[model samples]
Target: MKNTKKLYYLIGILVLVLLVWMVNDTFTQPGVDDLEMEFQEVAVYRNENNTGPIKRIYAVVVSDTLWHEMEQYGKLMPHTKYGNTQVYFFEDIANAPEKINAQSPYFDASLNPFCIGKYEKKAMGEEHFSKYPFR
Candidate 1:
């Protein structure tokens, strides 16, 4: 009878340990709270600067890589900064340059180093309309 009671106690202990482990695992699991934090951080940074009516601007098509060109241009021009710039990806500027023009106020500028030849393309930044011409 004593040995049987010991076996029952052992089983109870094992079950209790398992329950505790499962509870711990569930509590530690990632939840919506983590994602909410990331979104909140993004919102905070975007609204930090209260400036002019945020312009919806698009950049011209370039022959070389899109990111490399945007980075170079952003460094040179204040408006081209990542937060302010919106790039439009195009296969060839000549093929659909009109599409860029149709979208919004677009600046006609090519990547400075044109000798590198054609490569992949990408666009960055949000789209906004200008109250006046891009100039």
Candidate 2:
């Protein structure tokens, strides 16, 4: 009888955990939430099929002091006869993670670039975003 009671308790606990996970998943925002704000970056991809490049915006934040150190060591980051990496230092506020200036258009993704689903970080690539149904 004691074994039966313990089994029931374990099942109940499992069920409760599953319920909690479902609830959290239901309430969580898609995509945009997954971005690591402190290291936001924006890259422009020049697709061969497209005449114009696609802009992928991101935020990259680093300490002011580190920026200087990197600057000295980064002088010849590319190390070639031409081209270089210029570290632009700015206040953290410039890309404050907590402050989102984005405007979520009506969820009719057909009218906007904001995907109606998950928005993974830039490093993850573009497979996750559905920047479509919109012009």
Candidate 3:
């Protein structure tokens, strides 16, 4: 009788644990949340045929001059000579990881062509952003 009782208790514990795990799996899967969350608005160019639905967002940086040039062009002009610029755009900047700004060696920290003066920052929403040649 004692062995039977112990078996039943163990089974009950296992069932409880399984139930909790199922609840967690159901609630925490990626893209399953129904909550309305905030997203920074920005723009990007993407081909649905080549890339899947995964949206690449960014923190865009450009110069005031570039801004004016883009305004004149009436759209973004992509330039590939300088490579892709790095601007930090986070979903939650408050809890974002530490980043090496222009002052860091990773950014070359030079004040010449690719310096901070030629940069402006903006959040690229849930879209792929293109690099435009700044006038």
Candidate 4:
């Protein structure tokens, strides 16, 4: 009888935890339409200034992610200083060059350096993800 009571308590706790998790998820996950890139420029900022709309970010250092040949808010992968990279996304510039896909590890060639003029520090900031000041 004691064992059965313990089992019931465990099950009840599990259900409570699940309910909490579901409620949290419902509040956190953004809608699919809000994530669409057609009307947004995604960014991962790194720092902030005291008197500006500026925020530094662990920008993808890859040359192709930043070029002068692509349009404003062109899509490219966001990278971090820790060697992790996010999905390809549109930066906040139109004229930036599109990043070319890797051909082969042994046959690689260097692309051009990043051009600061091609992007804004704040892309589709809060408009895209209100939780993260990405605009």
Task: Please give each candidate's TM-score.
Answer: 0.28, 0.25, 0.26, 0.25
Which segments of model 2 are wrong by more than 4 Å? 31-135
lDDT of 2 at 52: 36
Q: Global lDDT of each model?
A: 0.37, 0.34, 0.35, 0.35
Question: What are the per-residue Cα lDDT tens digits for candidate 3 across 45-88?
Answer: 32233232222212323223343332222223222222333332
What are the per-model numbers of colliding residue pairs?
A: 2, 8, 7, 18
Ranked by lDDT from best down, the candidates are: 1, 4, 3, 2
TM-score: the better of candidates 1 and 4: 1
lDDT of 2 by residue, 1-135 (tens): 999999999999999999999999998844423433232332111223233323222222333334323233223122222211222222353332332222232122332333211222232232222222233
lDDT of 1 by residue, 28-117 (tens): 964423331111110001123445433333333444444444334323323423345333333343433332332222323442222122
RMSD of each: 15.4, 17.0, 15.4, 13.3
Model 2, global lDDT: 0.34
Cα TM-score of candidate 2: 0.25
TM-score of 1: 0.28
RMSD (Cα, Å) of candidate 3?
15.4
Q: List the residue pairs that clash in candidate 2.
A: 31-118, 31-119, 39-59, 40-58, 40-59, 40-60, 41-58, 41-59
